[model samples]
Target chain A: MQISQQQRQLIQLFRHPDEVEFSNIDWEALILTGRQNGFLARLYYQLERHQRLEDLPQYAFKHLHSAKVFADAQRQQAIFEANEINNSLSAIEISPVFLKGTAYTLLDHPVAYGRIFNDIDVLVPKPLIEKTEKQMLLYTWFPEPIDEYDQHYYRQWVHEIPPLKHASRRTIADVHHNILPPISGRAPNIDLFTQYKIKTEYQCYVLSPAALTLHSLVHLFFEEDFSKGFRDLSDLHILFSTHYQDEKYWQQLRFLAYETGFTLELFLACHYCEAILQTAIPFTFKHELVAFSPSPMQLKCLNWIFLRVLQPSHPNYESTSYRLARLLAMLRGHIKKMPIRILLYHTGHKLIKAFERGILGRYSDTSSNLQPQPPDKNN
Target chain B: MQLHQLKFDDYIHKMTNDGLCLDLGVGVFRFKSHITSVQQNVYEMYADYNITEDKPADFHACVKLAKGPRHYINPQVHFESDVVTPFLPLPKSQAFPLLEWGMNWCLSAYDFNHFILHAGVIANQQNEAFVFPAPPGSGKSTLTAFLAYSGWRLLSDELAIVTPDSLTISPFVRPVCLKNNSIKLVKDWFPQVKFTDTATDTTKGDVAHFKPPANSVKQINTPAQIKAIIFPRYMPNVPVTVFKLDIIEASEAIASNSFNHNVLGEEGFKTLVKLVENVPCVELQYSDVNEVATFLQNEEW
Candidate 1:
């Protein structure tokens, strides 16, 4: 992607906060863009590392410092929630593998520094999925009260169960049996992932280095939404950079991607990271990964679409092409997830619900409730 | 420059495009909207605040009227920032309320430099401010409107941003929100005070905002030292009474009323402790605003 000068500056500051000077930067746009990409706190933490506290601009320093404080509190809360889940599921004889954000925090990876996460995703053995759900129910975790259609979709087609929320704490957990949906025809063997799980200091399991990178790749590239594209791509950059120093890491990543039927995901991750983030990769590996790329015409279209979609969705950077590209990406995601018939049924149902809510004015009354409450059916 | 200084057409054009950046004492906000009523409200309510032409803003917000599916059936207004929409849409007529609510949301949600309290603040001529840390319907707004129009300077009627290290309260001189019966009461008590058209059936029940005194807006950037913290409640026909609260009680009350105390963590705790330790805390219960106002004006702290 040919990022703008502002984006380039942001990337440089993100990578080497200690080296970049911030005297002449546009603080407003930088803060807005960082916030849009979920990197405001991360940016603040980086700047804090390199600059003296007294030298910073008052407005910039105060906001960033405040963000850092908030990030710390959220991180602590996430850890506490993870520990609670761990203690709850201890009786099931199945250790939950913390995935993505929670795993990053639990393992204390650099990526977790100043990261903000909403939900905890955990994976379990396919055979133990049923037992784990029952155990969670005993511990007061229930499947979020989604409607019948969504419940059916999750149970019959998706890789994970309907997201489970604790009754009191309201922390969400998604229990997954595979990385990709079974209906998507790309679901990898559960054993391939289970074999690489490693114990962490906190008594939970996280994916091994190679598996972690591959999973992040699958999560980022295979997902339909680009709302968190920049943040997720940053995660890939951090993981690759942290692990790439080991000579064996590259080979292991390639071998694992091939074994898990996710070589395309890994290739795209490497391709974009190298192009956008300037992540270093061995020349031979870059050339070798090209063999796993899609056909030339499809590759060209995808590259054009993804480059637009991956950029921060700030208005200052957005264009009509980007909006169209996002739509194309969403369509492509649905196509990749299910066969045409099921896709049509699902899309039709959602469209009708939207039409009813919008056109028919089914739920037009506005309530005066002031306190924040969990979203209910009426909302 | 101020918002009213611009021609109505120019103000609408700027607001619809980039946004009209207004300095709200503690912070700057860029507000964008295409709705004519919203524009008029801003012009009337923010006529005294500073308008930034090319300067950088601390926050950007917009009240976008709902389009497509829901527009024709029942129009709605959405409160959005550059990053996310914090709340669901409301009726289109409530755009002004949505703008105020959105601005408050931005300050409370994003501005972390200050320990924010859901309180009303009014200052004396010496710049010693009294903070009323209370919840909704606690007569805080009534007392604030009464004091502001009577003699005291209205710093802010909704938000009080106290610096964590210094415990100095920064001024956010905006309109005082008066709800339901208080709207009539304030109008009756202070006939000279200007108010925007009352919004009926609002979430806060027939809400109207009374303009701050001109002197208060002129000294918007001035900081004030905390003189006392009072938790006020209104009970009809109850004898007007004031009870002193200890440091622990005051700290707990202030913390509970704070918006970002938990997010501030240890710094939040320390700031609250310092505020409680140095200031006298009291709870005043009364029915009449004048009775509470007289007591507050005469009380020696």
Candidate 2:
């Protein structure tokens, strides 16, 4: 509940806007140490206003450094677009997903639009995946060794094949055969997905609204990847909030999941959207259509919290709540999957380690920076 | 307003109530009076003296700190000697925001063991943090401003701090740097967003850094694990496409854009690699923002 000193200072600055001064001393302490974007922005504005920045010869020199970054973005974008087009053409059935510049910008607003990309993404037909692989080689897009296992796994068991990379662009894109995994232990019929495709200026493939939401939820949870969840969450928030007005949308969503053999994804999607996005699904639809048990939002919130506790800094209030839900869900997962004996053993081990790292005040040589040596690694 | 003594030539001063600390230059000095300390140095700067004057007329009236040579300055002016850095002119905006946003990848890059990532971040009202990490042409700043202005909470528009845990993303709340056409892109998108004057042709090509929204300005230090690390490259006449990157490969890409990977050593590398491993990485190629938003709505992060 308490605000950090930095946050408190922000409040003071906002209240007494004019008196706030950005001096060189402030620059070294606050700006150099700062790790966030907001502080950088505020500083930029303050310097420009005072006119003190422009007068300094050194400041003008620094401007060149930032300018180069801008130029690189422009060049990188050109390279990315070329690769995406090439990748799409080579794939048997190329369908674009939530590529922010290509799709997110088209759907979302301008604020989420910053940053340059170095790659492209597209979905290809499952059956022609092997052939698509052949075409990719022609375009110089190859697979990394790490994806060797993923490719095999996806080809045999999952909805999307292992991601492919372009040798030239150094960018990789995933090729999806279906929106979600075939939970029934069989490849979910491809026709079911292709049948729901909506064509745009980009291409002729997209998951249905119901399917997209279910797939998004499954991706968020079952996939357990949060890299782009912020953007994805924003998207889901908008999609569900905007589409929920249609009374029949929920029924259709349930029907798609059931028919596509990803009923679990549907259940989870509803669980997360409501828990994090505060998305509302109709009660009648929940009762009559989605008979499959939906995970409780309260429990999900707890699961999220446990995961969030690992953050170096406490998450914002909403993030904290969601983390709690996610934490609870994680526990539920462990309980459902692991035997009681194994769970107890794992819990005991974790507790012992936590005690050592926390209460004992012992800094073990193993984890401590006892030895200073050069690190051997590269990009 | 209390001054304390310290060991070694290096003097120390800090705010008792806050996280502000300063390292003044080395010197052997005695307190001249209760409220003021006098020393003869490179010109004579007084420690604590309250004088009512703007740019003092007489330079010798101030207590002189004798280090090497006599440097002349107004006696009434209270120089910030607490911090080791030399006196600098006042910044245009608030101190915290200006320094937080403006001092990245500049002359003196601090060793934080994490890259000063150039990206924009935003969270929804729900506080789900999404990061768009890209170079200038990637349309990152433009997209960030658009998203923040639209509905999502603006976490940052420049630096995306990736901790050793790699899962945590700290907020920077820096201004969104809009270049050339993007200045119009954002202004046209959200007429309400405030912007600093567009400085012409300094480096980032007809650049203007958009002021952080009032709400976003307050939460600059709040950190979140990157929900998404998007690499956006804009291309005219190209259809929108998003590609998912494998974690290992994504790690390489992320590393390339890192500002402090070299300084962070193994822990930094491991953290970043693990981050890309756990999070989904994608390349977005697009020309329009609306479709991009629609596509974003369709995918699961």
Candidate 3:
């Protein structure tokens, strides 16, 4: 697809952050709407990465946008500190996965130091979630009770509970019990996080640099949960290029994968990061991993996998399509483990709904007006 | 109650006998003196007039009023320490009684960051809360009104606070606002139901308020755990049939209906999933209040 005018200007700004020469389009308008929104970042970094970052406009160098960057970084520091305080009091022992900005802060990057973080992501053991919640309560972080049944459900089932938000602090802490589904589902061996765990400087976080990379890829491909856009991709590029610099790191990563039961996931991440970011994964390592990941359907499956993960904002799409796509992606993720019959039942139901919405337009938002008013109900 | 006594900073006012306490943010308005006048407007609109006292206005924009020991109280408006106060003139005595029911007028003045959802909730005799989650036209308020009148305890006829782990409902049991024709349908079914006045040309068609069922008065402070989640899609002529929804589907629905899910992240996702697994979820299709009530009562909850 041809890039929109704003997209083209965004591409220019991102590639040449040092050059601020726009003819008619205001520089503030260019960066504020296009770049700040993460749209342009998504297009260039996630969708198209062959584009060079050196070509983007340079607003920071002019000292005008420098304050914005500084403020963002300071905001990140505040979040990190607040999260650290929560961690000190939390009951569950959580390992921080140094995601984008947090990771950048950890690695001492020369770029903007204090970026604003929306949340603090931490991985926790599944069994310890209840205890963690009790710990959260000690700090006055409580979930609003929607219903008793909902409370029972979250406490008993599910991967993680809704984030415990500090109402006054406005800090959101995501507590994950499992990295992957414990049931027959895609992304197995989530607990393997224990193997490659390492502590960070600020807190006692178990981080596997390689697992972190794979997790980022899982988030990118399967989760398509791309709210950060260019910034996240940039982090991926930096981490990949900087961490996996030696043959020792590559062999260690491969060994780490074999132990963790994520040989395919690690290999795919390495291959794609290199292909997309022009990241310098060693040729010998790339060739061997490619031989192991020989499936044409990997990319096709990856598309829906990521699409489901990213779950776009296309309100025009049918709810059934959204649900079916999610189910299919999930089933495929756990193909070998989960029962085919159960998957079939779930997938069939979703597919039928998708078909109904697609062909008959039975559930169009456009007909939301056709919704029966109170006593007018005549379904 | 007058408007001046409601101010949080001015607590030196004389208390009045037979006055209702008003808690509006930081300002307290002891408003029993004006209750009769306020009730005049409220009765014209078919809504009850009452006083809320000693309520901590957790939100910054609230205005409280109540009757003090010896004198009438005024409207009290509180502002957060750091933020500049917005201009909110206390409505005159005639406008006083209609404030709470008419607070929707102040909706535009608030920030647009949050999406406003219109729905209601009620708890069974067991105190298990059932969230009737729906968009504006789903007849949630109408159904909530019927249920409240049918002896079920009304929890809230508005916002259902869906938190990270549980769906907590506020015990704001005032009156259920029945819009447009639902008012007539309700009146025809329950001829004994006391309605305020039917105000016309309002947003939700012709609107009126139903006296909260007596049980609601007692349960106004009780918060119920969400036991059943019912998505009501009222088809004007359709027979009442409830379709049981599966956990996965219900989880998705709860997530979408949630006030602040995305901000909650993995915890939110897990909460919704957990809720679906435990709650008996269903999609109810009905036209008549009688069938809807019967179906709800008969469900194997």
Candidate 4:
């Protein structure tokens, strides 16, 4: 909800790269923090846009420039993967709805221009999810060899199936039936998103602007991982700046969120996008978003946690209270996504694993050669 | 000021407290380590290196001695490159060795500005760089340490920070890491060279790092133009053999040893072509350092 002084330096430069006052900045911390928050290359783009790259110290300039080169390569690879997946799934009469990073790349969204993607995320209709996975496996994409209990957990409750990784290429693709897990009881009807699909230039399907923005918002607010919080919020700012129109546009986005049972997500996204990123949301929408807000006490607590978590730091460097915030936020995420009984079961199972790894000196699977190989046991 | 100017106690206090900020030729690093082995290694190996006091560093790395219930039973030291541990904590005995490995990891992973080649580099008195590009067990580091003590200046033991288009490499004159039998053989051969205690049963067998010659560290800021690429392999009891490689053959061999040329793609290919065209490549196989050193001396650049 608020930027730290460190975040302010980064956000300020993002807003006005050409005008950045060099004297006040700690170039080392600034560079590392920018990189940690997934903004280094994006910041390169900003600085490049303003023709201010020449002003940076050579070391800073090289790192930022190098990040752009890397991000560009990753984006190209993602595009190639999306088209390959599109070609594969087309045989089964399913055009997967690419989401998040893949969708952003397919659409050539500037916000994602300099970002990295861990995997390609796509959604298919619930009925086709099985067929889609079978097709993927037939085409040399196998479910990642996760543990048996984890496999059961994903199958029983998670939004997506186990990730399907390409055999030779080792690239990952997340095939999802719903954006939100069905156990959330608030997973939107898939058809609502499907209606707005626009075929990309490469023939991969992506949601139209409004629906896409709504989904991004939902993903941002619901996910516990705040490591990419700044990147996601920055993306929303870019999307809003491009998509913002008169009252009708805001109204349509709100209606979609309401119809899809994500009014709360929409509210949080709008409030934070404006508050943190300084996005120019219409005053009318701001007033209307208030209706979706939690109580003042809840808001205060949310701000306390989100502010610290949003200013991302690597886990090792995190202060004890910040780690506590992350833990609370993670538990809060579990509660938000699962029913009470399922949440308890899932939490207990994970707690035991954590205990074994931490207190019981299992340490890691370092000495073990028991990793699941081909002909995965999960299937 | 050079690091050797500080008293040993003062250096350890500074390294553990305010951190030892080293301008390591290729990149500046702030090393904050409480581990005695790590501190001692820095003191011994980095005596002639410049210290950038109170300056912002390029990387903030640490070798922290692990603390927990497991600590007393099985002590380990984490090799954290900046905010994250690049590798799992190693046995506390391996602290100094881990730091050496961590420094290389930091350069390869974070210093995207240059072509960080997986090669050992040594420059003759004229500052003409000779690159020995080889994978592990190829005796690259061993050969590099052997040459550095035998009058050549060591540029780098693990990574060669090649500046693209400049056709030059900045000296990365840290300690040369020796593995397994080579550690003992090297220590015996070069009796005067200071070496860290052998870190037993490391991933690279028994590993130890010996200091670069002081002359190399003294010229840490000097950049050397590469003159020859010698792909070396240690063949026990083999006769000294030197085979000249044509440009294409040399290009392919050096390319395999380059870490980030793949990252650079076509541009890197062009640079590799230009380098091979300018610098002759050769393959050397020998067990005797004396024979290999004499061969290198007699060869035309």
Candidate 5:
């Protein structure tokens, strides 16, 4: 990815916290970019570790401090909710596997430090998906209402059911039956990931190091939206820098990637993590990674889109090319995700919904700026 | 110089493009609005706040007239504060009030370092502050407005900012939002006071804003030592009876009304317990604003 000037400074700051020349930095742009991209708190922790938190301009200092406070609270809530989910599922003898942001947090991995946790994702054995969801519903979890089509769509064709939100706590939990949507035709066999589960001290199940790395790599690569792409890529960078030094871990990641039919995700992860973040790779693995690179033309198209879409989506640094790139990414993802007929039905349904909302909105007397209506009538 | 000192033309010119930045005592915010009502109201209400191009703007607040091309069909304005917007778009008429509410959200949501209470605060000349922590329809703003005009320095009419682990409070004096029947009552009481044209049928019912006095803005950086927690109940035609609240009751009241006490968690509980014990807590019930003012003034410090 071609990082923006603001993004480069953020990466540079993350790499070397002690070298910040505050006067040269645009405090506003950096904070805005960091906030939009969800890493302000991580940078705060980095500065504190290097004894440079105190050196920040008061403006930057407070913004980072505020982020740290917020992240710390979320971490506590994440732990609490994870415990609750674990205890609830334990009743049915089902061990749900936590994934992504929540899993990294439960493992106490450095990558989880200062990460924002909005929801908890858990993978259940396909046989126990219904049983697990039932247990969750018994204890404060209810479906965030969706239309009949969406409900059918998730149960029939997708990896996960509709997300369950806690009644009082408002925490969302996604129950996945497989890593990828089963309809995608590219989903790996569930056994490839399920066999490598590691239970944390919290009695929660998580993927092993190599397995978790592959899961994250595949998740990022298969996504349609890249609003949080830069942050996800950074996650891969940290995952590699921490684990790739061991030849065994690197070999295991490649083996699983190939076995799971996600060699492309593995190749892209390594390429961007090293190329973008300068995540160091051992001298031995460098030449072998080059062998997995896509053809020059394909790589060119991928790079052009990824580079534009990965930067912070803030107005200050957002380029004119981002919107077009995002549209291309979304289109590429849809084509990759569903078969032809289902894709047409889904796309057509969404267009009709948008048009219906607009027509209904037009009937309301909203032309007059002075008259008051319900706050959300227009949106 | 305070914002009023800027030439009217330059002020509008600045707000239309680069935004007008001002210090609101607790933090500085850069406010931008293209809506005519928002500009007109802000020009009248926020005249006393200091204008600056400070290195770090604590919040970037704006009321934009555009939602998209379809915005021309509906003509709505949305309040955006920094990166997060907790509010939905309102009719363009509500833009000024929407921005004011947005500013409050920014302070309480982003600035978690301080304990922000959902209350009003006004202090005596000795800088001994009286905090009025109450719910909506409690006549809190009307009381705060009456006293702020009657020589008491206004610290804040909403979101009372307290320094953690201390009784010290900072001034966040902006325009006091007076809602519904209280708007007419306040206008009648202070005939000369300038107020925004009341926006009707808002979520809070008809509402108008009262500009705070210039003297309060002068002490924007000054801190106050909180001496009392007063919970006012506007009972009609009643005597100004001051009832004492025990420490536990006071602490519970303060805790429930606090915006960030839960966010701060354990430290917030400890600081609040200490504050309730330290301050004299009382409930003042009265119908007449003048009587309530006299009762407060004559209280033992």
Candidate 6:
């Protein structure tokens, strides 16, 4: 994948935050591009860790200060919401297992330092899914409105229920019964995943170290869109690099991957992390994972597509190949997610909606008629 | 060099490719617009501002016409930053106003180092500033226009960016946004003042922008010290009166009108408190701009 010079510098700083020699770099372009790709806060966190604030140019320092302030507020809000969720589910006696960003945040993992997310994702036992939704509703979380076709699709094929948003705060929660959809024919056994859950300091449960990495792999590799590819892949790098220091961790991860029908995902994750981020993997583990690698032709094609799609989705760095590769990857993702009949129906419905909306028309003119008003005096 | 020095063709070419960078007091804005109307608006309104040739800009803004089916039918214009579209498209006729709104959004949204308030600010020759914090329909813009022409320097008509460490308010000398009946009122009051073409049926009713005094644009980099905070309310057919507000009440009111006070957390709160404690606070009620202007002119700290 082709990356701009500015992106390369950002990645270099991410990997090595202690080196603060930025005498020749263009801080203006770097800051604007970082903000564009939603990496400014993360970059600020890294630089702050090394106490390199004084080294920044005046303009960069001011903007970075602002980004840091926003990131701190977001972190505090996420923590407050986590506590609220815990209180809401206390009656059911079923501790919701936090997934992805929320889990990392609750566990105080380094990967969560500057990360910002829109929704909190949680997994529950399949039998308790209904009870969980009821509990959420009792706590003022209402299900968002969905059209009939999409509602049926989620109920029949998706792993999660329709997303629920808090009535007052508008925070979103994705309630799931399993990590992957059953229609994919590769859903991990719920009981097996539950066996590996560990309690956090906050008294909520999170996936064990090996389960966490494997689930992240499955989530990223099986997705139809790459809008979040760069951020998710960075999470993979941070988690793997942080955990691989313990020999026991690596062995347990490999064992869990094979037992859970995710060896292929594990292989691709390690391959890309090393190939793209240049994350250091032990020679022995790299050799061992090669046994589960795909065929040579499949490996070549996957590498080409993942490399392009995984780069930052900023238009300044994107190209014709990037768009084509993303489209092809989307098709492959749909194939992996559903059977032929379901895929045809879903794609057909979406195509009709697109036609009716006239392609580029995401919003109706009637909706745009709402005028901007000044903020209320009492607000 | 100033933007006015560029030939129209050269300006369009630069804007389409590299961008035409303008130093806008607090930060430099690099703008690229394919629409001719937007270009003309910038040329007229920003003529007094400095132009940066190859320097880096704090923000990169563009106003691109919508493509595909909507482009040919009811053509729309979109305001874009590098990666995000902060707003929906407006009709092509509103491109210039869209540019103004977009530039204001970029400053108020991204410039987090300052404690930004939805207020009008102006200064005396001594650099003593009065901050007017009000919501819409408060006649803040009309009051500001009146003062700017009556021996007061127009600091800004909308955004007031106050530095946190030092409570000095930075000037953002852009055009004053006049809404509805205020549009015609301002035009009648200042017959010599230049305004962009009025945009009707906008979300803010009928909208137009009053150009800032060229002297204000020339001295944009000047920062002003706060001497007073005034909350203005306009009520028709009422005698003009000014009431002093307690320090606590004034601080709370100013903080509520700030754009990013919550994001700045404790520092934001402390800055506002310190400002209110040091400056006199007052609330003024009036129906006539002339009366409000005279009251401000006769007041002493």
Q: Rate the local accuracy (lDDT) of all candidates.
A: 0.81, 0.48, 0.51, 0.80, 0.82, 0.81
Clashes of each: 0, 118, 96, 0, 0, 0
Segments in model 1 whose C-alpha atoms lie over 4 Å from true places = A16-24, A52-57, A283-291, A361-379, B246-248
- The candidate that wins on lDDT is 5
Better of 1 and 5 by TM-score: 5
**Can you tell me which runs of candidate 4 are displaced by over 4 Å?**
A1-4, A91-93, A245-252, A283-301, A312-325, A360-362, A366-379, B243-252, B276-278
| Cα misplacement distance, residue B192 of candidate 3 (Å) | 52
Candidate 2 vs 3: which has more TM-score:
3
**Model 1 pairs whose backbones collide:** none
* Model 1 clash number: 0
Q: Sorted on lDDT, highest at the top, how do the candidates line up?
A: 5, 6, 1, 4, 3, 2
**Candidate 5 chain B worst ten-residue window by lDDT:** B81-90
Ranking by TM-score: 5, 6, 1, 4, 3, 2
User: Where does candidate 6 stray beyond 4 Å?
Assistant: A1-3, A17-21, A365-379, B246-248
lDDT for position B173 in model 4: 83
lDDT by residue for model 2 (B1-301), tens: 2122222122212111121221111101111111122111111211221122122111111111222111123112122222212222222222222222223422113324344555677776556677677766778877877777776677667666666656776665545666788889888877876665654643345656565565664455456656677788888877788888888768777877776654455665677777777777888898887877777666677
The residue-by-residue lDDT of candidate 5 on B1-301, one tens digit each, is 8788999899999888878989887787888888888888888898888898754677888988745555767677777765565565677778888888888877876887888888899999999899998988778889999999889999988878888889999999988889898888888888888899888878888878988888998999999999899999888889888889998888888887888786776667777987987888888898888998887788785
Write one digit per residue (lDDT tens) for candidate 4, span A9-68. Answer: 888898877678877787777788887887888898888878888888777887787777
Docking class of 5: acceptable
CA shift at A272, candidate 2, in angstroms?
A: 4.4
Which is the winner by TM-score between candidate 1 and candidate 4?
Answer: 1
Q: Tens digits of per-residue lDDT for model 6 on B146-169?
A: 888676898988888899845699
Per-residue lDDT, model 6, residue A54, is 71
Model 6 has a DockQ score of: 0.41
Candidate with the greatest TM-score versus the true structure: 5
Q: Candidate 4 docking category?
A: acceptable
**Per-residue lDDT for A62-115 in model 3, tens only?**
222222333343445544644564465443444444443454455454222324
Q: What tens digits encode model 3's per-residue C-alpha lDDT throughout B131-220?
A: 887777888888888888888888767655443455555455655677787889899878987766665654345666776665575555
